[model samples]
Target: MIERLQLLVAERERVLGHFLESEQREIALACHSIARAFSRGGTLVAYGVDSAETDAAHVAVEFMHPVIVGKRALPALAPPNDVRGVLRSGDIAVSIAHGAEPAPVRAFREQARHRGALTIALTGGDRVDSDHAFAVPSEDPQVVQEVQETLYHVFWELVHVFFEHPGLLDDACITCGDVAIQARVVAVRNGNAVIEKDGLREEVAVELVAPVDVGDMLLCHAGVALERVE
Candidate 1:
């Protein structure tokens, strides 16, 4: 068991090593896409189909989380949770799927693209060629799940750089106006938890509506919070 565990850790490191090796280029590509979308006044949308839902949420949280660079108070809209909600085109979508496009993601992308969003597809190693695929090139049967999860994070980390160092947009949002808004938490908070936004890390104000914790992606605006990012 110990040997297997060690092997797994090594393999995981190799995957990350590849990521680090290409960080500069990957960040360039990802930031370029993000800036292009933002230049057109686009929203960032994230979602996953079936089991990939968790990855979708992770992508959104990483972007919206405090101190994570492009950490906007902007609420990430997931179409499956609210079918009637709008996801217009020009929005950026970080989608995940192992082999094929999931139904929920397909539906959401359809709506988003029709509205004019640019899609960034993050697929598993098993997936066929995807122009938008952020390839990790791993085939560890014991760590398929880990690879899928990593794929989600690797892209978003690049997304963060896109907002901070801004290789592509060149800090376009520096002068952009803010959309003043507010929200309230719908649940509760236990232990040490806080709300993060706009590089301003503030402790979650309300408990009932501020049900978030470490690693959770929350939607915050004007002291009102809602829709945990998972």
Candidate 2:
């Protein structure tokens, strides 16, 4: 029994590690989009099929009532039936499926897309159609669900990163006096750079600090790079 437990633990680690490595960038992007939606006063509507129903409720609670001290609550919900009538533009739709893709989940995501809402699909099978689909690279339903649980938790925790930089949000146009956060550059595109700090990611204008590359640290304020930190 002890040996079997160890094997199971090792397998879980392998599956989780591989997923993080492959989906790290995508996860960050999804978090960024989620934060944007929340900042714009949009709600998160989640639904799950089969065993994932519990996951939908868990994610909703985590976002609506944050566990971390000082973290503000965000709008999230898990509706019992079809959310097509509930979703609106700028809202977020999350569809969770453990192993098989059901018709309702598919229609939920499709309607979300058509309504201009951000769609995220978490499933164990490939070929999901959504703006951000994370398919766990595992055949076992239990392992896939576990990994997806971790994924949504990560979303709940890191979505607050964008909140820290209010100036980075389009809906927030406030002056942050003498406040500059340090972040490491992860990706550079045109005049903007994607930065990460403590698992929170944001893209700020780096035109002022031209020629900055990935792995460089910079001090940012009001959605713009102040200077490169040596």
The numbered model that scores best in TM-score is: 2
Residue lDDT tens for model 1, 1-230: 99998987998888767755764454455556665566557767777767666666776666566454436544455555843255665577666665456666666655654444555665545332211345445654335456657655555555555566545564323112355223222212232233433422333444544435445655544443444554
After the best TM-score superposition of candidate 2, give how far the Cα of residue 226 lies from its true spot, in angstroms. 34
Give the range of the ten consecutive residues with the poorest summed lDDT in model 2: 168-177
Q: Evaluate all candidate structures by whole-model CA lDDT and list the values in order.
A: 0.53, 0.83
- Give lDDT for model 2: 0.83
Candidate 1: where is the Cα deviation over 4 Å?
A: 19-27, 68-71, 81-85, 103-111, 126-131, 139-145, 148-157, 164-230
Superpose all Cα atoms of candidate 2 onto the true structure and report the RMSD in Å to 1 decimal.
Answer: 8.4
- Cα displacement (angstroms), candidate 1, residue 136, comes to 3.6
**What number of backbone clashes does candidate 1 have, counting pairs of residues 3 or more apart or in separate chains?**
14
lDDT of 1 at 103: 69
Residue range 1-230, candidate 2, lDDT tens digits:
99999999999999999999999988987888898889888999999876888899999999999888899898998998777899998899999998777889889888887777788899886947565789998899999999999999999877898789777556432214377988888655445776776655566887889888878999898888889999
